[model samples]
Target: MSTLVSKVLVGSAMAVVSLFASIDINNASADELMTLNGIGKGKAEAIVAYRKNHCFKNANDLSSVKGIGSKIVEKNRKEITVGECKK
Candidate 1:
């Protein structure tokens, strides 16, 4: 491959990575939530379940979930959001 093509491929990959780096916990699916540090399938599902009864106003609200705590929230704060997800 040419140098330009290689650079374009690398740039595209980086863009995709950055796009998924921060996810909206309120709107994210279990898979998306799993992208956060220390969050697995069970915790992701818990987040979804908690959001069903209570909407998150901010990243800190994640602590209200059964398995989530302040430490988890703080650890993934930069990678989490409370924005509405685009359908």
Candidate 2:
């Protein structure tokens, strides 16, 4: 039972690591963007549009948009990426 619990904990940690590592906004679709916390369809559209118009150089650029705030950024930080360089 102890071994099983250890395995479960390790697996959970790996899953979380992968989630943070794979948040490539360049390839994310509208539906995927919406999955981020505090993101709705409109905010998702703004994200995509911003990427198209100016190209994202870093995650901090997201805060420049009209509706995004620090709270939203913190909430969605794990599910978003910028400067992907291949949109």
TM-scores, one per candidate: 0.78, 0.64
lDDT of 1 by residue, 5-83 (tens): 9999999999898766888887998998998888999999998888777888889888988888999999888898789
Deviation of model 2 at 86, angstroms: 3.5
Stretches > 4 Å off in candidate 2? 1-21
Candidate whose TM-score is highest: 1
- Model 1: residues >4 Å from true position, as ranges? 1-8, 85-87
The 10-residue segment with the lowest total lDDT in model 1: 78-87
Q: Any residue pairs clashing in model 2, and if so which?
A: none
Candidate RMSDs in Å, in order, are 3.5, 4.2
Model 2 agreement with the true structure over 1-87: per-residue lDDT tens digits: 699999999999998875565455666777777777787999888877877766656666677777988788787776677745664
lDDT of 2: 0.74
**Model 1 lDDT, residue 26, Cα:** 79
